[model samples]
Target chain A: MKEIVVISGKGGTGKTSVMGSFSYLGKSDLVIADCDVDAADLHMLLGPDYQRSEDYYSGELAILDQDKCINCGACLSVCQFDGIQSENGTFRIEAMNCEGCGYCQRVCPTNAIQMETQKVGEWYTSSSKVGSTMVHAKLGVGAENSGRLVAQVKNEARRHAKKEGKEIILIDGSPGIGCAVNSALSGADYVVFVTEPSVSGIHDLKRVTELVKGFSIRSGCIINKCDLNSQMLDELITFMADAGIEHIASIPYDETFTAAMLEGKTLVEYDKGPASQVLIKSWEKIKQFAETEGCLK
Target chain B: MKIAIASGKGGTGKTTLATSLSSHLSETQDVVLVDLDVEEPNSRLFIRGDQTHSQSICKQVPEWTGDCSLCGQCQEICNFNAVIKVGTQIMLFPELCHSCRACSELCPESALPLKPRKIGMLNQIQAGNLIFVESRLEIGEQQAVPLISQTKDYIDNHFDESYIIIYDSPPGTSCPVIEASKDADFVILVTEPTPFGLYDLKLAVEVMRKMKKDFGVVVNRDGLGNNDVLDYCDMETIPVLARISNDRRIAELYAAGELIFSTIPEFKEQLLLLERSLELSTVVDPV
Candidate 1:
């Protein structure tokens, strides 16, 4: 199966909006996964009916037993992560700050600290309204190991795609060039970047594209709000050309985007506006590119 | 007072609000703006200034010195899978290491030792009284929290509490956002007025409440989407700090990396009101 991940280095560039339209267009042939576990919103548009969910545990947390604890502060001293909190004569472990490195447990003089596996999030397999298997996850608040959860979601999506004989695995990736984005891009066949014609957009695109180039993935760019700044648009076009990235589509700024989002619909499904038409044309190009480029070995 | 401007959703005007607010405050008072979104820091795009300083930031990870006794203790103790023993060779993956020092300390033969690996760069710029500090993660680096934490430490070492510090935090309700906002005196949650906006806003609110942080909301693109976000904030009794109207002119200025409060009179007025509200909030909950 071919995997195509849509990501924007900067947030609010319409990554999900584009993914929603693509999911609708790809239908049963696609196994969709939303790897933006931090603030996943693709499900809001796809209307997935969750079929199964599994608690995902990746890291460990140090739990201090106050009964066995001595006030020596050894665990506090060894912890690189400020996980140990000391007040008066008492010591506590802050779960949020704990890196699950188990250093505190090894350093505890009284053996007061114990390492426990932490359930950082949950992943779900669902059938979306667009008739495709959807795999997504919700990372716990203030939780670490989001990259692992993204990897889990992608693996689940791949398993489903292979079992169901799906041709494509279309993924909606997160907004930053961090661990989660790295996990989502692993083993992907094609990468589609959804960006805007803005200073921040171009700046972030440059950074993320640099990261992607390290993987040598075949990629394309979709410029949303292309009409907002003519000068910025030219800059973006020039950058794409210089970077050897194909400019797949240039969508004008249209209110139909928010309008469709408000109604819980994708831009293409909502109305045939100018932006929708451009995206429809671009979808064809993405399919052709994905097929011609061949799958990653 | 230290204020963090954050949003759960990307492109929700966090940088716009942060840069504009810092620029406005710098007209009279010294302001410190730190962009904690190390993975994709964009505040530098809008808040240009003279380069004052730059430095490469590194995180500590364990490195094998090839003196292993083949005890296999380091691999067993490592929780991040950053270290592994392969056929008489020990491999270390610096990108995956959390630098917790467990593997290094637990190694029986002292084969693993903590070493610094460059993960990002920190730059300081000066625009009049506004000090803009931005950290950008190096390409192929998987983590952002270490850079963010180091940047905060740099800010604490350089800037005193007399200046108003603003953090342009990364989007999401995850560890990076938590690390950025955890030490702030107050947090300003920026959001647009859409279903996705409202959904992510609630997640952000839950995170702030869990952190027990005092926060308010500023709705950007006010008229672009429905009133669900405003209504949710109202129901939650969270203060609506400001409302930046959905204007094409504002979008154009933002697209061109221009500050709205500096050019738009109405936006300037809104920002002044926001400043007043911030003053009232800070006074009531003084640090």
Candidate 2:
């Protein structure tokens, strides 16, 4: 299956909106993966009915065995994270504050502090109204293993695509070029960069583009809300050309995008406006490029 | 006073406001600016100063020695699979290692040794009366939280009694942001008047509430959208510290690498008001 991952260097750049519109256009043949585990909002727009969920455990957190006799301060001194605390002559572990480093478990003289695998988050496989399998997750609050959760979500999407004989796997990647984004782009066939037309937008675009190129993944750019700054749009186009990146489409500023979001609909479903038309055309071009590159086997 | 300027969303004027406020405050009083956004630090662009000191921040990862007896205990104990043993040869991926030291401490054969790997750099610079300390993670490197923790250590060790330290934190309420905001006297949440902004601001507030840190909001691009942010803050009883209008000049100045308070004299007065307001509030222990 051909996989296209849409990512924005910065947040709130219409990455999800563009992905939602693309989902509407390619409703039948695609599997949607929301790799933005830090704040997964694709479910809100796609309105997926979650079917199956599995707990994702990657790191070990300190668990105190209160049955142990002596209350020693040995674990507290070695814990650099300040995860261990003493109160009322008893020792306790704050899971949220723990980095799961196991230093406390190591330093505990009595072996009372045992390392236990804790569920940091959960990944879900769901069915969206668009007839596409939606794979997403919710990172536990104060959780540290987002990269692992992202990988799980992508793997589930890949498995679903192979099982259902889906033609495409479209991923809504996380913002920023962190571990989560790296996991999303590891095996992707194509990457679409959705960026805004602002100074910081251009700045982050360059950063994330460098990251995307580091993986040797072919990428195209789509400047969302390009009318917000015409000068910036021209600069972005020039930059894309200089960087040997193709400009897929320019989506202008539209209130209908927000209106659609408020109504729990994609832009294509809410309004058949120019923005929706541009997104549809962009989706077609992406499909053509993927097929030309033999990504859609 | 130690104040942390943070935003729930990236590019929401955290660095911009922190640098502007630092430059303004430095004119009259001693101010130290700490850029704790180790993942993507850009504060050095705004504050050009000669480096006074630099240090390396490292985290401990397990290094397998040739003395391994192929017991497989390290592999079994590793929850992250950072340690893998195949055919009596043990391998470790440092990037995947959380540095929990579980493998090293649990290995009975003493095959795994805790090795410190430099993941980032901490730099201290002096710009007039203000001191700028910035933590920058190495390219393609993980572990921003450790660098932030070390930066906080540097701040504690080198903080001057007469200087006001303003911390410019990373976006999001993750480990790195929590590390930056820890032990701060006050936190200033910078946001814009948009749906996404509101969504993220609430998340940041939730984090602050969990941390029990006192905070207020500063709405950037105030007049661009309707007063939904103001209304939300009012309804929630969260104070709106300042509302900066949609100022093109300020934006241009920021893009041009010019300090806003220096270019726009009026912002200096506004920043002074913010300083005074923060000073009047009682300080609380961040812990």
Top of the candidates by TM-score: 1
Index of the highest-DockQ prediction? 1
Candidate 2 Cα outliers beyond 4 Å, as residue runs? A51-58, A66-69, A86-91, A129-131, A196-199, A225-243, A251-277, A294-297, B50-55, B223-228, B247-257, B262-273, B280-287
Q: Write the per-residue lDDT of candidate 2 for residues A235-293, one digit (tens) a residue.
A: 88998998767789998767688668766789899988899889889999988766656
Quote the positional error of residue B146 for candidate 1 in Å. Answer: 0.7
Model 1 lDDT per residue over B14-33, tens place: 99899999999888787999
**Candidate 1 clash total?**
3
Clash pairs, model 1 backbone: A11-B10, A11-B11, A12-B10
Candidate 2 C-alpha lDDT tens digits along B21-58 = 88777877778999887766767777877999998988
Q: What share of the true interface contacts does each candidate keep?
A: 0.91, 0.15
Instruction: Return the lDDT, model 1, position B195.
Output: 91
| lDDT for residue A17 in candidate 2, whole number 0-100 | 81
Scored against the true structure, residue A239 in model 1 reaches a CA lDDT of 92
User: DockQ (Cα-based) per candidate?
Assistant: 0.85, 0.29
